[model samples]
Target: MAAYGYFLSCEEFSPSQLLEQARMAEQAGFEALAISDHFHPWNDEQGQSAFVWSMIGALSQVTSLPVTTLVTCPTVRLHPAINAQAAATSAVLTDGRFRFGIGTGEALNEHILGDAWPEASQRMDMLEEAVQVIRELLTGEQVTHHGPHYTVQNARIYTLPEQPVPIYVSGFGPQAAALAGRIGDGFVTMTPDADLIGRFRSAGGGGKPVIGGLKVCWDTDRDRAVKTVHRLWPNEQLPGELAQVLPTPRHFEQAAELVTEEMVRKATTCGDDPDEHITAVRAYTDAGFDEVYVNQIGADQRQFFDFYRTRVLPDLPRSR
Candidate 1:
């Protein structure tokens, strides 16, 4: 069955606001939640970035919906061992309603510790090894290891959930998706691309869950919504590997200046029309995604939730 979730954007919101959003999400009939982990906002215009672990702890207290990190990089800024410990504790806090989503990570977040950013291929290798180490530690056993990218010495996670935490791997293309199929508990991707989902399953993903996420702006004025997205998330429309390699918020801001209002309108569903919002979400369901998370890209969060609750959510195809 397909489940709908809400996305909590750490870069755009404070920890307290996120907790409130989680509560509102459950009230608005969202079944799950996805949160982003960032060291810095995509650009200064997007503003705040909070520690995701602390926000996750708070989310566990406020809501019962299953929570997953949309994608966290355990390879660089933080060691896999520490990530394992954090994930274990979060599983306990959420009372086992937790999924750990991981990726190769962007330079904007991972390069903070003065670590040199490796090439994309090297980062992918590191991510795979990191997942291996984290899975071992999540079993509540002592782990000692040395790998090409990371090392763990006699580390064990004492606090763990009763069941194993599911680790979902995120990717943008076939190479990383194939790795996810082989090593991840599930798969995560940003687009509602059916071909990618098909590739993941064919590459040994089998019956594991595939999660997708996208942003939408709900307002009476479509033009205003477009401008809002243009101002706040032009980073979303960047092409190629810019999102992965950009090292600072300022760099992203410079890059995002190239994004036009038309691009934001073309990429995200904006405005109050229930039909538009419905179509945006149905794309994921049609693509065979097991779970889909929607992010409200502007300040009209309450309005967006109300729109979903009273109009959009009820009309969505239930069986897809």
Candidate 2:
């Protein structure tokens, strides 16, 4: 069955705003909540980046819906042992409703720690090792490891859930997708690419859930919304390694100069009507996602939720 959910821009909102959004999302019948875990926003203009672990703690108390980090990098910013403890505590606090979603991550976030960012193959290798370390720590037993990528000594998670939390891995390419299939309990990705999911399952992810997300702007003025998205999120259009090599927001701003507002509008749904949002989400469903999460851009949070609840949600193809 396909589940519908909301993806909160955790790096773009204050902790208080996120708490309120979580409450409202639950009230609006969202089945799950996904939060972005970034060390920094792509651009300084976005204005917020709270530590996601703390935000998840607050979210657990404020809503009944299940929560997952849309994607977090286990390889950088935090050590796998520490990540395991954080996930364990979050699972307990949320009563086992938290899923730990991990990935190799972007340079924009990981580079802040001053660690040398590795090549894609090396990052994937490190990700696999990190996952193993995290899983061991989550077992609530003392763990020690000296892997090629990370070293751990006598680490244990004291506040684990009765059951281990599911791990969802995000994969952008074929190799990473196969790894996700082999190691992850579930799969997470941004684009509506069923071929990638098929690759995942074929690689051994049988019966595992696949989650996808998309960005949209709901507003009365379509053109204005598109312009706003381009202005604020222009980095989305940049392809490949530029996103990784760029060191600062100013670098992103310079690259963004090449992206047009038309590109943003064509890539995302932007309009007042609920059907537009439905159409955009349907693309993911049709592409074979088990869960399709939508992220509504802009500040009119109430209007966005109300429109989805009243008009968009009913039009979606229900899960069998």
Candidate 3:
């Protein structure tokens, strides 16, 4: 059976709301959580971007469900060594129920430091080196290295869990997936693309956990739910690599203007039909994702959880 998780949208909720949601999620029977990490929301309409590390620290205190950064970018903004320290401390705080999920990152968050965004290829290279640095530091051993994309000098993570934290790498394409296979303890992506998961396994990631997530609005008024997601998450419909390269929330707003209501309807599952929610989430399990996270796109989180606990989770099958 695939474990179902609640996805905390840091871009759309305040820290307090997130904590409460975490408690409600566990009460609803979700076994884990995946939270977005961003310096800014996709647009001004979404209106919140609490620091993920701080939210995680708060989550550790009140929730028992395991938490993971849906995908933090350790390649830029924060050095990998610093991220390793934060992650180690988070695992300690969470009683070793934390998993580290990381990606190359977006220009919107990383560019705030005045660094030029590297091409996707170079970012992949940087992610590899950064993961290596983090793995070394998580061992609680001092590490020194100078690689193509990063450098470390006797950096070590002092606050560590009993076991080294599992690092999951995120990738949307084959090249990155293969890298995730070779270096990551696990793999993460957003879609139900079995081929990508197969590629990861063929390249050496067999038997490791695969985490995937999708967005859904669980309101009874279907049209209003669509409007809510359209207003707050038009960025979801952007094609190609726009979500990764857009430099600011305003740029995202401008680009997202081109996203139509119809596209949002086609991309997200909106409404209260438990059957539709079951079908929507089942795709991830069918695609071989070991865990699936559902992000409630609007503020009606408690309603969504109540619905899932009663109507949705029963219909979904678990693979683990």
Give the winner by lDDT. Answer: 3
Clashing pairs in 1: none
lDDT of each: 0.91, 0.87, 0.93
Q: List where candidate 1 sits over 4 angstroms from the true fold.
A: none
**lDDT of candidate 3 over 1-320, digit per residue (tens):** 79999999999999999999999999998889999999999899999999999999999988999999999999999999999999999999999999999999999999998999999999998998998898889889889989887889877777789999999999999998999999998999999999999999898899999998999998999999999999999998888899889999999999988988889888899999999999999999899999999999988988999999999987777544
Model 2's C-alpha root-mean-square deviation from the true structure amounts to 1.2
- Between which residue pairs do clashes occur in model 2? none
Better of 2 and 3 by lDDT: 3
TM-score of 2: 0.97
Ranking by lDDT: 3, 1, 2
Indicate whether candidate 1 or candidate 2 has the larger TM-score: 1
lDDT value, candidate 1, whole model = 0.91
Query: Which candidate would rank higher by lDDT, 1 or 2?
Result: 1
Q: Where does candidate 1 have its weakest 10-residue lDDT segment?
A: 311-320
Q: Candidate 2 residues 1-320, lDDT tens each?
A: 58898888975688898888888888887889999998888887677888999999999899988899989998888998889989999999999999999998888889997889888899999999999999998888999899898999877778889999899999988999999999999999888888998999999999899997988888889988898788678888998878666777778888888999888978878988776787789888888898888887778788888888888887887674
